[model samples]
Target: MAAANDLRRGMAIKYNGNAAIVLEVHHRTPGNLRAFVQAIIRYINTGKSADVRFGSTDKVELVDIERKQLEFSYKDHNGYHFMDPETYDTVTLQENLIGEGRDYLVENLSVQVLYAEGKPVQIEMPASVNLKVVESAEGLRGDTASNVTKPAKLETGKTI
Candidate 1:
């Protein structure tokens, strides 16, 4: 158990008998009122999010979370496939779990997968990825504007 005041983003906790991941946390002290902790958590089972409040001194049950580094293998009709570097085993994740991170996925890319209660919960990608621009319009002559932009398609089928 841990105090509500010690809560931090990305921490997992058991709330109302459900395992949830803390997405955001804020400590607030309203005028003439006791201080409280405000947090936004997403339930692992239902994938639903809720805003909760707890007294500053309240105890919260912490859940164990594990992170594993996996390398991207490929994506087919079955789903996205990843391989564990140490075990040489393949793990397939559904499309819903991949989310927008699919835009940055490439062959042999390393990513972090978060597991809660021995189940995959989230995928963490690097802050930036190097991708090849497969399609883009040619720039016009003297179009060196500082803020100029154009539509481009990445190798992973994401348009930016």
Candidate 2:
């Protein structure tokens, strides 16, 4: 157990008998009222989010979390597959859990997957990824105007 005041973003905790990941936290104190902790948490199983408040001295049950570096293998109708580099074991994740991160996914890209109580809960993406530009229109000659932009299709099928 840990004090609510120690809560931080990305921490996993058991709230109301459900495992949730803390998305945000703020410590607020009114002029004359007791200080409290405000937090936004997302439930792991239902993918639902809720705002919760706790007193500064409140005790919160902290759940153990594990992170693993996995390499993206491929995606098919079976969902997204990843491989553990050390053990050579493949793990499949659902599309909803991946969310917008799918746009940046590329074969063999390394990413961090977080697990709480032995269940996968979140995916951590790298700050930047290099992708091949599969399609782009040729710029007009002498059109060297500043701030010029064009649509580009990446190898992952994402258009920018």
Candidate 3:
């Protein structure tokens, strides 16, 4: 059990009966009442997260999350693929879970994939990735005049 006041950044705890990380915590003290807690939480299991509040003395359970570094291999009809750099183990993640981050992911990019009880929980992509601009337009010498940016295609047949 953990005291509400003991919460810290990155600490995982039960929130609304779901595993969550303590993103932020706020303490509230009124004129004549006991202090309360308000926290922003990110759900651990499903990635569906929200903000919630609790009493200053509220007791909660903590959960530990394990992460592994995996190299992105490729994608096919079976979903996105990743391989553990250490054991050469492979895991596939859903596309919906990847979302807009997919646009920045590149082949062989290293990402941290989280798991709980041997079940894949989340895939954390790197802050940046390098991809070949497959269909970039001919760079006009005067194109640098403005701050405007144009869309470019990647070697993977994706456009940004």
Which candidate number would show the highest TM-score if scored against the true structure? 1
**Segments in model 2 whose C-alpha atoms lie over 4 Å from true places:** 1-6, 24-38, 54-59
Residues 82-103 of candidate 3: C-alpha lDDT, one tens digit per residue: 8988899888888854656677
TM-score of each: 0.81, 0.79, 0.64
Q: Please give the distance, in angstroms, between residue 151's alpha carbon in candidate 2 and its true position after superposition.
A: 1.7
Q: Better model by TM-score, 2 or 3?
A: 2
At residue 139, candidate 2 shows an lDDT of: 87
Instruction: Pick out the ten consecutive residues of candidate 2 with the lowest summed lDDT.
Output: 140-149
- Candidate 2 lDDT for residue 56: 97
Ranking by lDDT: 2, 1, 3
Per-residue lDDT over 25-126 for candidate 1, one digit per residue giving the tens place of the 0 to 100 score: 999999999999999998999988899999999999999999999999999999999999999999998876676798899999999988998877778888
Prediction RMSDs, each to the true structure: 2.5, 2.9, 4.5
Looking at model 1, report the run of 10 residues with the lowest lDDT sum.
94-103
How well is each residue in 1-160 modelled by candidate 2, as lDDT tens digits?
9999999988999999999998889999999999999999989988899999999999999999999999999999999999999999999999866767999999999999999978787788899999999999888788887767889999999999
